[model samples]
Structure formats: structure tokens, C-alpha cells
Target: MPEFDLIVIGGGVSGITAAAYARRAGRNVVLLEAGDRLGGCCHTWHPVADFWLELGAHTAYNSYGALLALNPDTAFGNLIPRAKVGYHFLKAGKPQSPFGRVGFLEAALTLPFGLGKDKAGLDVETWFTRLLGRGNWQRLLAPAFAAVLSQAAGPYPAEWLFKRKQRIKAAPRKFTHAGGLQGWLTELATGLDVRLGQPVQTLSMADEGVRIVLAEGELSAREVVIAAPLDVAAGLLEHIVPELACRLRATVMAEIETHAVVVPAGKVKLPPVAGLIGGDDAYFSAVSRDYLAHPDWRGFAFHFKPGLLDGDARRRKMAAVLGCEPADFAYETAKTNRLPALTPASVALARELRSALADTPVRLVGNYLNGLSLGDAAVYAAQGG
Candidate 1:
């Protein structure tokens, strides 16, 4: 049995970042991953291509101070600013531009169902609606938010939307790492003791410390920090921390499902922009070009709308946008990964979970717990709070 001061479960961004922080604190740390490879969902496996095929997040905004701090050189490299955003709506059996990115959003606000454009005595949403207008909401803001969050609007409270605008308003349009974020995670793990292919199955606590049972064997740690998924961590800590487990189980993690189709750059027929959306299917579907900071290898991605977590329904819906058999476009690639969507309720639950574990030295971190950005997670872990 190996002994350490801290053990971080799950090799995803949060766990990796947590381990890095523990090591920086000069504490004995051991990191464990279930899969043979690290990066978890961020793992980009491109067989036909030479470079990393981003199966998960493509861009980390400039606002992600923690991510940037980990790589003082800005591992994201040169940024390709957002060029033009548009929506493809099917009218008369043809893809027609119903609205430009900004126009659609502005229009959406004016509609009765939308956040109207009345600014006087307006609250946060009304003010935002007036600022964006109906067209922008329908076209740009709505779709863009959907793309980032992986769910359609309306399911989340209006306040949630307002908070997000405030959080990322100053962020860059979008940026990708020169070598991909996986490289950065790899580099971050350096000099730290990481146990790869060892998934934490169970945990127990005693007066001395905590006992962790991994797939390989058992080990003890003076302090334990669970940085895996809430549900996953819940199961592991059910006996160790029943109160925290119950609290975590009560929370809802938004499920954002996306499928990536990697085609040869030469074979891909692309528009002028990198990210494109087709139709009002409550989601964004388009081909991604220059994904790996290279001008080749376009990846066509389909993301479900906000609150649209119907795995079967979403796949069926994407068939029309993708112009391919729905079965072929199934989310079998890199297994099925569900992006964590944070609603106000979920957000509150996360806060409660954090508070419960605050005193005992169990730190929770992830896209679900934090904001929906990889850079944010990195920054949160780097701050070491």
C-alpha cells in the first residue's frame, strides 16, 4: 500500500489540476486515472490524422486566468478570432439564412416568448433582452449560448443567463491551443506522482486518515480530495461522507451531448467561418476547420440544445443537419460523453456540496462544479482555494 498526503480521483481536468496544486503546495500527492490515457473527456484521439482531434472542448477563452497561469506562455498559441456567425434554417426544403447571428438574437427578444426589448424599468433579463434585442437572441446569442452550454434556452432561469453574460463578457471570442489542451494537461502533470490506469472504486475514513480502494489495490492518504464527477464521487464517498454524498446526489448536472466527425480537410466543404449552426433545432450543428491550430482537418460537430438531453431524440434531430444517416453519426466516438450543464438549481447544489466539504479538506472541482469552461477549471485549481 502506498501512502500519500492527498489523492485525486479522476484524471479529467479538475483532478489533474487539483493534483498539480497539491504538488505545488509541496504535499505528497498521488493522481489516479481509470482509463489507460489521461485527459479524460479532453482526450483527443485522431487516428487518421496526425494531430490531436479535439473530441471535447475546442477553445479556452482568454478570461481563463488559471489555465493561462498554468502555462505562462499561453499554451493556446495564436487565437483565431470569431469571424462570422450565422444560422441555417430549412425553408422550402432548402437551407436558408433566416437570420444573421446578431440579427436572429435581436429578433428573438422582440417575440412574445422572448426577452422583450423594453429597457425602461427593466430587470437584468429585460435589460439584456433590450441590449441584445430579439434578433440577436434568436440568431447569435441564443445559438452561441446553446453551443457553449449544449442545451436550449428557457430551461435555465433568466438570472443564470445574466450571470453568464457578466462572467464571460470580457472573454476572447474563442482560442485553441497550438498543440491542443491535452499537451498542456500533460505538461501540468510533470514532476507530480500520477498513477495512470488506476480508478478509485471505494473509500473509507479513520482517525489516522482516509483509506482509498483503487482497482489495483488499497492506499491511505492523510487527506482526500475528490475531483471527479459529482455522481462518481458520490458513490466513492457514500460511506466516507454520507452527508456530502446525499447532497451531491440531489444536484442536477446538465447533460450536453456532442458528436465529432473528423474528415480530411480537403474533403470537407466549409463556409467562411469555423463554427456554423444549421436550423432552429434548438442546437448548433456545423463543421469546425483549423481545429488544432492548423488550417487542415475539419471536424463536424453536433451539439444538443440547452435542456435537450434526449440522447435518442438529439441524435435523430442531428441527422437532418448533418445530411447523414443518424446511425452513422451516433455518439460512439470516444464513447458517449455528456457535457455538464449548470442551471441555477444545479449551481446552488454545487455551492452546497462545496460548503459541506470545505472544512474536511475534500476539494471538488470540474466543469459541472465551476463554470462551463476548461480554462475556468484550471484557474480555479491554480488559485488553490
Candidate 2:
């Protein structure tokens, strides 16, 4: 078995960032990925005739400190170029306002106290009313936040909503890449030895180092970062701490289904808009017109918010939304059970888990531990890895 100074499990942004940090520190680091390719959820694919489609993450907000710190020269690089990035919101199956640079303003005006009673003092609206005054929440913020977060996870808690809104309100006008988010991963993985298709089956701590048993072989590392899915990490830790596994078992429970919807080139006119869905169902989708940026490649992706729609219900909803038969898009679906979520329980469990492993030398990182955003993962990786 080969040995290294650090071994990172999983190849998502979290794991990749960890590997990059360790390698930069002059440590012998090897990244192991179960999939044939890297970029866990940060994936972009350009099919034969279709536009660029992102199977996982869409775009990171400019406020992502970790991502910026990792690559200081943001003026030009792969993270997201200065163009091809815009924001919009949809209401009643139409743009909230007429097209132009006014989309952001329109969204800010309409969505804030999403789905709650128009009268102040209700859940989301109460907080918004406090921010923009009583009636202002109804006109500008609630609907917009509602429109975006509605498709995301749960009701936008007052605290998180305020923080996120402030950040977005102070962000750059446009962002993204001509080749898509894949370039960010490709650049970040440079100089690191990544072993794809290597699924780690077991991991253990030894007096000298950590031992990782993969499907094909075994390897050792002085320190290991368990950046895989919570369940995967819990399974490997069961032998070490069964009680921790039990606590983690009920902490996160959400099966996610991903589908890529192709909008015919020049056929569908989608003004650039991206946000969380509004309503009780919590579905988040980002609409992009410049992922590929070519006249020929036209494509968009819709992601089902974890724990939002059940399998059959989600399929039906997607079919109706896409205006295509179920079978037409069924083949393009990718499903991952136990997708990481930021539920209250999961959040609490993350704190508990962190304390549990604080002195163990095994750092746990992922979208689950932090908010389910590439920015969060990158920030965490840069800060500690």
C-alpha cells in the first residue's frame, strides 16, 4: 500500500479543495473519487447539439470568500468570468417584470416575505416588514425571496434571508464562464494527483496514520479528510464509533433527482434569470441562456430541491414544467439518495459531529456540513484544509 501525508475522500468541491490545500502545503496528497471524473456536484456537460448543462451546481455568488481567497486573481480566471452572468425571477409563469436590467430590481421588489400572509407579523413577512417596513415587504422583498427560496428548501428563515439578500444586493452585475463551471474544477485540480474511479470502502485510524481501504487496493495517509457524503463517512466510521453512525443516520435524509432540460436553440427565449422557487414545495432551479453562449448550443438545467418532491410527484411536476413527455426527459435523469441538506437537524448534527471529530484529525467537509453551496464548500476548504 502506498502512503501519503493527506488523503481526501470524495472529489466534490469540498474534497478537491482539501486536496489542493494540502498539496499546496507541500504534503503528499491524493484525491480519490468514486466516479470516473472529478467535480462532485460542480459538473457541466455540453452534449452533441445541446447547450452546456450543469448536472450539479450552477454559480457561486461573488461573496464567497473561500473561493476568492483560494484564487486571488479573480479579475480573469475559471471561477466565473466577468460576463454571461445575470439574475431574474419568474412569477405566474412569466418574468416578474419586462426584460432588461430591471430584473433584479423587479425581483427585489416582488419577492421577500414569500408565501406568508400579506399582512405583517406572519413568519417571513414579519421579518421583512422589520427590514423594509410593513408594506414594503409585500411589494418588493417577500415575493422575490419567496419566488427564489420557494423552489429552494424551506421557508427563508429571517436570519439567513437577511444575510443572503445583503450579499446579493452588493454583488457584481454579471458572472459565469463560456465553457461552464467545469473550468473552475479543472483549474482547481491542477498539480494534484486525483485517482478517479477509486471508491473508498473503509477508513480507519492507526497509531501512525489513517488507513483507507478502497475497492481496488489500500492506502495510508498521515491525516485523512472525510469529505464524502455523510452516509458514506458514517459507514466507514461505524467500526470506529457506532453511536456516531446512529446519530448521523437520522440527521440527513433526502434523495435528490437531477435532470437536464434542453431548450432548443433560438426556439425558447429565456431572459437570464436564476433563483429559488416559491411555494411550499421548495424546488430550486437556475435558468441560463449563456452557459454555452453559442447560437447553436441551447440548454438549461432544473434541480429538484432535496426533500421537496417525491419521486413520482417530482417527475410529474418536471414534465409539466418542461412541456415534454416524461419519457422524453426521463433518460436524462440522475438520482442520488441521501443528498446533503441543510435542515435544522442536519445543521445541529454538523456542529455535534464537528465537536466529535475536533481532536481526531479527521476533518468532515461537504455541502451538508455547510450550507449546500459550492461557495460554502470552497470557503471551508480554503480556511482549514
Candidate 3:
């Protein structure tokens, strides 16, 4: 028999959850992470006392059943209500509310269409344009989605949007932990045989089982779960599963840079809002911070367009959006590249690849195969998808 019933690669939310569930099922499982820590994209940083700035995913809906299941003792705090909420938009280098007079008129003329029923076989850009009108699509939909997806919108399937709409409407209460997502991840990782900093160099499937070659040593398992990003998975599976690797390579991935800065609460005058979306070809769609928990210090976090930018250029752009001098802000930045472009063709190819891998011992999990949310990944991993 193989050394373990299953070997799960990557220690992100999905991989952690999968290992936990496998343990619950009485399977001998081991999780491997390339980094020194777990919680791949759900990372938190503390630059100051009593201030936890999340560099990755910060919020979760009440409907995230899988996440809740893993850490039942977690305490979640709710976000500001929708009706009372407002966000800033950069207009002529100034931060203005979208609910202002000129913005209100534009919204009045365009917002109604977004509430209408979904249409079949439409791409995301086209569907939103048709449903919410061109004005709303440009001013609201484009930037808002750019922030959410961490990339510019392309020909994504409208079906995904429809499901997203339902999830949004159903999840009225958005929640976050006091210690951020890292606390919850730590709880989920407890007792699991996790090996950090042991990046798998290659993988092969033999008659005995799936062979995983790591920098330290080689390990074999009866089953393998690749919970890593698509690109990383493609490289690892190149020798064993060439067809699957080829398909994974075909999917486009977007890199996103996030900057978290702390500013004196008195110096920054932000509206009572959660976030702001940028207009035109702005580098960022949203710039905001955790206001509910830390009211004393204004912690600003912004997502950047794909590709790298020098420190000086990033500082200038952020200063422009916040209406503050670059010298005034103390900030830290992190870059990640797992957000897949879910265009129609890519979605079709993913589906085809998934179907092809169903019979094999190697199972795929993560935002690429499943949906992009922590909840989606957790549920999919639990189901062994």
C-alpha cells in the first residue's frame, strides 16, 4: 500500500480544507506547502498595534457553509449595511461619491437594467452592458468587477454572473474575523500533517500510486489532490498528466498587486463607505480599509492592474487616488497571480479537462477548477472535486 491514502499539495484554504475532510473520513493524509506558512491568499499583516490589515481575502458571507464548518468557533463581524453605504470615485483627481448629483442622474438612468433577469449565452461584459446599460457598465460595473475579480473583465460567461447575483442576494450578512482569516486558517490546519517549505519538484503516476518528488525527498500516495494554482499545477503535472497540464496551461492567469497603507485617521477624510471604484483606465477600481474594527487608524488597501510597477510609480498613483502626498502614507505591498480569466472558451476548456480527470486518482481543487471565493473552494474541496 502507498504511504498515505492521499497527499494534498498546496496549503491554501482549499488544500487545508481537503486535508481536514479527508482526515475526518479516516484517510491518512499529508498536506505540503511551498511557503513557510499556510493561508495562501488569505494573508493578514499587522503594521501597527490593534490594526490587522488583510493583504488577501478579507471578508466572507454568512452563506459560506464550508468555511464555517471547518472552524465552528470563529466569531464573525458584520459589514456596514447596503442602504447606508457609500463609496468614493476618483473624478479629476478628486474623490467624489457616486451618489452625488451628476453621478445620481447617471445611476438613475442605468442602474435599473442591472436588476433585470439574466439572459443565456451572453458574455459578462455584454450581459452587464445590456442589463445595466452602457453608462452603468462603464462607470460602475467595470471598475467594481475589476476590484472584485482582481483583473480586467473579459468575455466571462454570463452564467457565472447569474450565479454570483444569486449568491450576493442570498448573502445579506458579510462577516470577517477579529484576527482576520489567518486565525480561522490556523484553526483548520490544526492536527493535519502539514509540511511547509517542501515544494514538490515533479509528479508522476506509476502502477503503485501517484509519485510526488519534493526537494527533500520523494513521497507516494494512493491519491493526489492538486490544490495549487493552475500554472504551478501545470508545471508539476507536465510529466505525469501531460494532457491535463496542457489544458491548465491554456487558461489565462492574472497577477494582482495589493498595497496596504496606514494613515492618521484625522488626516484622511473618507466618506462613510466600504470602497471606491476608479473611472476610465485607472490603475485601481477600489481603495478602502477596515473601518468597522479600527476607527482610530485609517488602513487603506488598493488592488492594482496586472503586471508590475516600480515603487515610485505605485506611490504616485496611490497618492493621486487618496488625495495625499506620497510621503505621508506608510504602506506595504504584496503580489499574487492565481486569478484566472474565466472567458467562455477558458470555462469550456476547464469543464472538458475536469471531465477528463474524473476517472483518474488525481483530483484538482482550487479557484481555477471551482469558483473564486473562499466558500466556493472550500465546498468544492470537501466534495473532492
The prediction achieving the highest TM-score against the true structure is: 3
Candidate 2 TM-score, C-alpha based:
0.74
Cα-based TM-score, every candidate: 0.74, 0.74, 0.86
Question: Which pairs clash (backbone N, Cα, C closer than 3 Å) in model 3?
Answer: 113-131
Please write out the lDDT profile of model 2 over residues 1-385, one tens digit for every residue. 3478888999988898888887778889999999887877667776654456666666666676555455534454444434454444456455554233233454465456443433221245555554445445544455455333323333323433323422332334334555556666766687889898999998888777789898877998888887788778888778666787777765544554555555544454445444323333345454454533656544555555565567777666655654455555423445452454344455566677777777775777876665556776666666553
Query: Candidate 1, residue 114: CA error in Å?
Result: 13
Give one digit per residue, the lDDT tens place, for model 3 in 1-385: 6899999999999999999999989999999999998999888777886877777776676666776666644342222322334466766755666644244565567667666765455677887776656767776767667766777774666666425422433333665566667666866789999999989888888677798889878999999998998788888778766886887787878777676777766656554456666555445545455345356776667676755566678777777666677777865655553577777665565677678777778888887665677887888898876
Models sorted by lDDT, best on top: 3, 2, 1
Candidate 2: segments with Cα more than 4 A from true spot: 72-75, 79-92, 97-152, 155-174, 269-272, 275-283, 290-292, 305-338
Instruction: Using lDDT, give the best candidate's number.
Output: 3
Tally clashing residue pairs in candidate 2.
22
Runs in model 1 deviating more than 4 A are 72-140, 156-174, 240-244, 253-257, 291-296, 304-334
Order the candidate numbers by TM-score, best to worst: 3, 1, 2
Q: Which stretches of candidate 3 lie over 4 Å from their true place?
A: 74-86, 92-121, 162-172, 307-309
Question: Can you write out model 1's per-residue Cα lDDT over 130-189, one digit (the tens) per residue?
Answer: 566755555556555555555554344444342332233333455554445565577667
lDDT of every predicted structure (CA atoms): 0.59, 0.61, 0.72
Q: Specify the poorest-scoring 10-residue window by lDDT in model 3.
A: 75-84
Candidate 3: give its CA RMSD in angstroms. Answer: 3.7
